[model samples]
Target: MTRTPETPLPSPKECRRLREAQSLSQADVAAALGVTRATVRSWEKGRTTPRGTKRDAYARLLTGAEEVTPHQENPAPALVGAATGPVQASPDRAEPAPEPPSETSSASELAPRPAPELDPDPARGPEPELGSGLSPEAEPLSPSLTPDQAFDALYAFCAPALVRQTYLLTGRRELARESVERAFQLAWHRWPEVAMDRDPAGWVRATAHEFALSPWHRLRPRHRNPEPPPAAPADRALLDVLLQLPPVYRRTLLLYDGVGLDLPETAAETEASTPAAANRLLHAREAVVTRLPELAEPKELHRRLAEVASAERLRAAKPTTVRWGGEQRARHWTRAAIAFTVVLIGATTLTLRTAPDHYEPPLAPGATVYGVPPRVAPGPLSAEELALRAKLKGETVSGPERLVPEAG
Candidate 1:
């Protein structure tokens, strides 16, 4: 007699656990492999083993292992012929029972066909859930505003602070100004989306900081050169020292100290946590103190504050405008006058082209006309009026009439 090999089966609990670990539903797994839920359940319950390619697929999907052949692990045994009945004696002849279907045969028999090639990484992994689980239909904080209105409000509230922040971050006056302007332009386009957020100003500040640190600006040559250094007064020296710090530390210190924002507000503006902002401020202060020990002393700091106030006042009191030269003003007016004249000429030309082909003089002040004349000025004549008039008058007049004989 010959014995047949029993097929190995998978545990149902293991199948369910693997599916759960990968965050996949039975339906999802079934759909991916083109198999029905019942088929998967039957395999898991050990009622029947997935044979051939299906057995290989099962191993691959569940264990993430390479496909294994059935013959390698379980070879077919030889079969024996039955003994003859009655008195006849016979030798036991052994033969292989139809080499139990090959591994390929089992795979081909699966209801849900296996893929030609299996993927090592499927989209069944766990994902981090970051935002609140509120439905997308939740109400926004404010009614939506048009892009223009949102931009106007944002600019009015944040432009001044943005300008100062940019200067502190970059140390280049022109670059700082340009960065603020560019940030506002971008904000104008994204205003509708941004206006719904809790902190639009924070959004703008982060955008401005990113613009200031863009690759183009980072790769630009610094202002220093080998030329002889320009002489600078003590106050200018102090300002220069303040500008030389790295952008992150400089911005963190200025927003807290100069702008007078609380730690939380500073953190929001810089897009950092309160603790991070505090650490940045502390490091910046320490760096400055180490560099300028005398100014860092408490007593000296107070004295310097008084000096700073006086200098600020002097700067504020200085005249804000300077007169341009007469020649410059003349040139400006000349350009304006030329532009105006060109516009006027264009308007007249367009009117002539589009107007009706008759001439009507404007009514003079205190003049009145009650009735139509025999003929109206030939229906709003245009720029070609003179030539038209000459042609018509020539046609109306008689040819070569003599007036000399009329006196007799």
Candidate 2:
């Protein structure tokens, strides 16, 4: 029998857009398509194309998602774990599979969960409509909340997950916690700016990631000695491979694969061009695959990343603690600056008081005389004295005659 002609699917970008338009994450699509999340990612990235039944299923999924609501606003994307079996098309699309527990979930769960769409605190009163760029999930803060309240909410929502992510980056629980806390502290200090940001989570994430991967961490006394590796051999191996990658490469990989950020978003966060970020990710993946051939597939790599991150009990300080610390730090620096200013003013005043009003010309250094008189006159004086002495000696006589002569 002649093979049935295949129906063409949309371009990779269009496929991603269609899925995103429905607010379905890669995992949700992957689960519904009986493929791994990495495979879905690759398909979107245009690295690999789905074949045969998989292609048909993905096309149907996209088509169904598109036809459902052409003009409706997309809800905040829901993160879920991958499930087996092909997605079935019904009168109504099937509901997403339930997310697994945090401990056993994939790396996507290690990423900060989106904030609830609706404000939970009724006491804060109703909130104004959010701007198009600023989604409630991306930025959880309601306009009614005070700056401190907004900061706390954001911190509470993002800090725990950020700590876990940073731990995966640095392989040190303390550093991870510190990084997240510091990032939030900074965010709190710059509350107005951060609150206004479209993606506050992204802002904090970039800061925490930067802090976690800082070269200065290598100089820290505590970090000089390596932290204990994961008890599981596989986890330890995965962490080792991750740490072996250069900081830039490691960061790019983690943001894309581990944290589940899109390539463009990863590039933006990393402050690299998209192509550069892609190259770094590619090289990083290649290096990881080289060390552990088993992780050639992206899904396996993501699972291992989740395991490594979760293997350690990484905890973040409370939002209150972070806020207090940030305020204290700000106060300390402000006081120090004031003290420095005072000291500078005092020194300037003292210098002015002690300084001479007018310039005084310095005395010129003495010069040696070129023509000095010789001592030849001393020889002539000596000759005259000798003649006078001879004359006095000739005048001497016998005792009585000498006495009469002396009397005369």
Candidate 3:
């Protein structure tokens, strides 16, 4: 008996069942096809069909499944070539299926969906347009200050805290002053990006700590030489010992003992977790105690630290201004202006050299000989010699045409 052909098109129920068997949801299928879940649902419900390119995509998907699972109930038919025999349905089916509609010139049509709406929160503004709205005239609400201004404001706010921290880190009155200045310069450069961050003070403190331990600051002549060490007063001798410690131990000890920063605050400034900072501080305290027996005696170290703290407060309270004006600003602008002028001059020279030359002036007239007789005279010649001269020389000699010889 001749069997009826299996439908080329899958029914909505069959499509849904096939997808479910593969453990794929409508959203998953839609994502794979770069379409919306609604589109996949419509296709499964037979309200709409996947068409043209999408139809080809559907065929590919089915073929992929058949390749992977050859024994699956519904194997895909050969789409490109003619079938050798009639198509058969799975034997478990109770009812016979209808014949597939003949192929048509027009494929199933997919309708375009509306774009998704964005979140309504004001904080969720559109991404900034690059190189746009950055003009000078575009004023920010707060009358946008420069990096220098922002740094100055931050320095003022954090100065007291920073000075105390600086003294703790450097163990020197003069070194701490210099370190804080250097840190402020670095902060001024990054202020545009960092000023609004939640932990700007911590950033400054970290920067100052790094500056204190920098090669330029830490590698003093005393550190390099073992013999003929530099002399210091008793108080400075104590500070010098603190400064001589390894950077990690020094900072850990300073944060806890000198600055009185808690473990968490120290961790925040140093960019370490709290437990790590606490461990470091513990080790540092032990090391300092081991090296300085006086500091190991609790009351003596506390007394020295108190004196240092007092000195730090005095330094912070004094009016100090960083003069970015005068020679420094002049030097910066002078270098810039020199560079600009050099470029301008170079451009002008290039333009002049490449340009065509025109209208060259005539050579100047030779000088006039007003008083001088023409350098040699136009002298007279004898007539006796005229006849002999005429015969020898190629001249038509007239009767007394005196030969006026050319001057030598």
lDDT of each: 0.45, 0.62, 0.48
**Clashing pairs in model 3, backbone N/Cα/C closer than 3 A:** none
In terms of lDDT, the best-performing candidate is 2
Error of 1 at 369 (Å): 99
- Return the candidate ranking by lDDT, descending: 2, 3, 1
Candidate number of the best TM-score: 2
- Could you tell which candidate, 2 or 3, scores higher by TM-score? 2
- Regions of model 1 farther than 4 Å from truth: 1-146, 221-235, 268-273, 292-408
Off by over 4 Å in 3: 1-153, 218-237, 273-276, 291-303, 312-320, 323-408
Question: Candidate 2 on 1-408: residue-level lDDT in tens?
Answer: 112345588999999998898888886775555334655776787754554445656787787733332212222221111111011112122222212223222222222222123332357653221111223344324468877777766665566556767777888888888888888889889977777653566678788888888888778788778878888898888889988888899888877666555454456567775456666777888899898999776655655665566446456688888999999999999999999999999999999999999997765679554488765654444777889877777774642233334454
Model 3 over residues 170-211: C-alpha lDDT tens digits?
Answer: 555566666666666656555544555434544566777788
TM-score of 1: 0.35
Candidate 2: which pairs clash? Answer: none
Of candidate 1, the 10-residue stretch with the lowest lDDT total is: 76-85
- Each candidate's TM vs. the true structure? 0.35, 0.61, 0.38
Candidate 3, which ten residues in sequence have the lowest lDDT sum?
77-86
